[model samples]
Target chain A: MERIPILRMGDFLLVTIQVDMHDELAMTLQDDLSDRISKTSARGVLIDISALDMVDSFIGRMIGTISGLSRIMDAQTVVVGMQPAVAITLVELGLTLPGVITALNVERGMSLLRERVQSE
Target chain B: MNVLRSGTQAVRIEQDVVLARQTARKLAVEAGLRLVDQTKLVTAASELARNTVVYGRGGDMDWEILEEERRKGLRLTFRDQGPGIADMKLAMTDGWTSGGGLGLGLTGAKRLVDDFSVESAPGQGTRVMICKWT
Candidate 1:
């Protein structure tokens, strides 16, 4: 099975989704991120989705689920690099992604994650 | 209206859903739709294709590029022989899903397209058709 790699970066976990993920792949990612958060004792999670052109209901739901899971697991999650087209489509699809944090790019996302983690 | 190209792709598993999105993107581009419009159509296709797999048990996505009176468009129809929707009215309602989804698949897809229609019965399978013109 294909898996999206989760990179350990100091106190944070970084996931850069570059492929057009299928449904199962998206679900697997949710599971893997949760496990990594617990094992690494990571303080934050940063997901880069610039490469993805679309965010359907499934992927949208997955993102929200990941955010919620990481939070209860004692980690903050920040999603970054959403394409403009994807943002437009996501809202039109009726997914506002409530309760999720977002940043413009990885650098900003990392800083935001750092700020949130430190302030907590 | 005239069909410039037409084809059918299976939606049996998770991967097929990706293919359906790719196919819709291609057709939308070929139809000369704007970037945002193309994204909307492809997103709608992704939603419907997934419903066909998860709810409809497996199905097919039929695509056609159309031209009429100087306007170009892309049309997609998702069909499945699996157990059909029992209450289409409730099924089409926003935030209502039988499959643990966000219930946006049907309602959201309908919002993303210019034209949309669905036909289904208890044992008669389901067919959802949507069109976008540019």
Candidate 2:
């Protein structure tokens, strides 16, 4: 079974999605991340989607679910590096990805996650 | 309209959905679609392909590159033999899903393309067609 690697950086979890993930992979990541957060007691999660070119409703829902789950688990999630075309397509697709914080890049995403974690 | 290129990809599983997106992106690029157009077409392909696998139980994505009056376009048709949709009006409505999804699959896919249409019945199968012109 293939899986997306979740890197632990201090109090945050960093996930750089570089694959064209299938539905199962997305579900696996959701379960895995929630499990990791509770086990490691992480404070924030930074997901880098810079490599992905498309984000349909399924993937969009997965991101929203992850964000909601993290909030309940006492962690913040900041999605970063969305391509301009993907953003346009996502909005046109009617998925606003509500509740999911976003940033321009990983550096800014990390800072945003840090701030959110500290403010909590 | 003339079909410059055409092929069919099976949409029987989750991985097939990803393959469908990749194929849509390649054909969209070959059709000379711009970046945003390519993304929209690929995103629409992803949504439709997943619907074929999930709601349709299994199907095929038939693709064609069309040329008409020096304009290029990509058309994709997702057909499934599974239990068909009973009500298209309710199915196309946003946030109304029978499978516990966001219910944006049908409606969202429609908004992302230049042309869209669907055909389904209670006992007959469903076929959804979408086209993006360059």
Candidate 3:
């Protein structure tokens, strides 16, 4: 059982995805994030996917689900560092992930998450 | 019977579909496709590969590297011998799904590749082919 480490930075949680994601691993991340969010009572989550070069329909849906779950748990999730290629693919797959927020990079995403959390 | 031939990457399990995406990406990059094209092809491959394993109950995907006078292309064909799709028109429709999914795999894969084709029957198997040129 492989695990993706979730790092805590201040009141925010940071996750950097580096593997070629499979269905089980993606689901594991969702479960791990949900538990971490409730346990730490984190205000925001910043997911950096710069190392992930590919995203499929399943992964796209998983992302949307994660963000929606985080919102219910009172945490704002901001995904950042999406490559141009991955963006194009997501659109083509008709998965805009309307429920999730995105930013250009980790710095911007962290700021955005903070702003959203503060506003909430 | 779904058999793996030489050079054919068989995607019979969930993990195989993940490997399929990796193989597609590597081939797309080796074909000199741009970053966006490579990503699109890889994504499409993932969707189709998952379909083969999930809906079709297991299948194999074959990779072909093509070089024409003008461009080089990578083509992938996914085949399955399980209960085949009965309605091509309905299956290709966006938001229409026989299985539990976003219902975007068939239609979305078509949009991402340069060439796409599907063949299936109610009792026969399904074969989907897609190619991207650079």
Candidate 4:
């Protein structure tokens, strides 16, 4: 997996994760992100999952959990760029994560997060 | 006419995960559950089936269709004569996964249904029961 930190237009810290949506790796990634978000106290987190073609039940649940943990740590999380098939599979598996937000692209996700941060 | 149809079947699969899911899905539908309820039932069954093959060294799933006061539902029990879970608490915790299982297997399955229970001992084997209402 490749993780890169980027600075957005509105002072939002964007972390992009590029990797296969496997179970073990996804959990590990979540752990790392959660730790980093807690330590940095970032305003928002943007996860770019565009490269992932498929997300099984386990990975989907982890994403949901990560979003919740981020909120607890005082950071909002936005999942960006999910494939259509992966989205369908997650819904079919009956895995509905309540608080996490999704976006069709990274720019939109970052925009939403920026707006959220500004409003809050 | 009987309100509920119940039966038990056992199969041994070396590493066939798809077959296990198919069997569970079929049983859930045949038991007169709604589509959404069937999805939850099958999802839970898939998790147990994978565990049976991966951690249990093989096992069987027992199921029954239940009816009461015009309400219908399905109950499934998965039993395996393999090494049982040593730490039930840790196993149920979020993000605590063994055997490379995503760690959501037990918890997610539990949330999908209306009722859930687990019985296991170190060497006595493990049994998981879950039920979903239609």
Worst 10 residues of 3 chain B by lDDT: B1-10
Candidate 4 residue runs with Cα over 4 Å from true position? A1-120, B1-3, B14-16
For B1-134, candidate 2 gives per-residue lDDT tens digits of 99999999999998899999999999999999999999999998998999999999999999999999989999999999989999989998999999978999999999999999999998788999999999
> What lDDT does each candidate get?
0.94, 0.95, 0.90, 0.71
Tell me the tens digit of each residue's lDDT in model 3 across A13-108.
Answer: 999999988888999999999999999999888888899888888888888988999999988999999998899889988989998999999989
Residues A65-117 of candidate 2: C-alpha lDDT, one tens digit per residue: 99999999999999999999999999999999988999999999999988877
lDDT per residue for candidate 1 within A16-103, as digits (tens), equals 9999999889999999999999999999999999999899999999999999999999999999999999899899899999999999
| TM-score per candidate | 0.98, 0.98, 0.95, 0.55
Q: Model 1 segments beyond 4 Å from truth? A: none
User: Residue B19 deviation, candidate 1, in Å?
Assistant: 0.8
Candidate 1 steric clashes = 0
Give the TM-score comparing model 2 with the true structure, all chains together.
0.98
Of the pair 3 and 4, which is ahead by DockQ?
3
DockQ of each: 0.91, 0.95, 0.88, 0.06
Q: For residues B1-134, what per-residue lDDT tens digits would candidate 1 score against the true structure?
A: 99999999999997899999999998898999998999999999999999999988999999999999999999999999989999988998999988788899999999999999999999999999999999
Give the per-residue lDDT of model 3 (tens digit) for B9-106.
98999999889998888888887899899999999999999999999999999988888877888889999998899999999999898887899999
Clashing pairs in 3: none
Model 2 C-alpha lDDT versus the unseen true structure? 0.95
Which of the CAPRI classes, incorrect, acceptable, medium or high, describes model 4? incorrect
Best by DockQ: 2
| CAPRI category for model 2 | high
